[model samples]
Target: MRLGECRQLRVKDMDVERRQILARDGRGQKDRITLLPEKAVTILR
Candidate 1:
């Protein structure tokens, strides 16, 4: 993901059970869903 996307992430954007992240205002000003890297799970929690 881009640095901007990461910076915009909020706690509510995380779906830990599904290991997903909702990236808002992304490319073309559209929203998208992306997989959360397994390595980041623990840190995010």
Candidate 2:
């Protein structure tokens, strides 16, 4: 995800159980779902 997308992320965009991060309004003004690494998940929580 781009810096802008990351900045826009909220708790609602994260699914810790599924290990996913939803990147809204990404490149081309599109939405995408990306994997959330276990290491990152630990820190996020």
Candidate 3:
């Protein structure tokens, strides 16, 4: 994912239970979910 895409992610869009990140493009098209790494989750938390 791109830096801009990461920046666009909201806390509400995150699925902590599944440890995934739901993101969309700047245009709000093509939504996708990316699994977060354990280490990354720890840091984000």
Report the CA-based lDDT of candidate 3 relative to the real structure.
Answer: 0.79
Candidate 2 lDDT, tens digit per residue, 1-45? Answer: 789999999999999999999999998999999999999999978
Please provide TM-scores, in order, for all candidate models, with all chains considered together.
0.84, 0.85, 0.69
Where is model 1 poorest over a 10-residue stretch in terms of lDDT? 36-45
Per residue, candidate 3 scores C-alpha lDDT tens digits across 1-45 of 768878987888777778888878744567887887888778877
In terms of lDDT, model 1 sits at 0.93
Candidate 1 — which residues are off by over 4 angstroms? none
* Best model per TM-score: 2
In order of TM-score, best first, we have: 2, 1, 3
Whole-model lDDT, model 2: 0.94
lDDT of 1 by residue, 7-31 (tens): 9999999998899999999989999
| Per-model RMSD to reference | 1.1, 1.1, 2.3
**Stretches > 4 Å off in candidate 3:** 26-28
Better of 1 and 2 by lDDT: 2
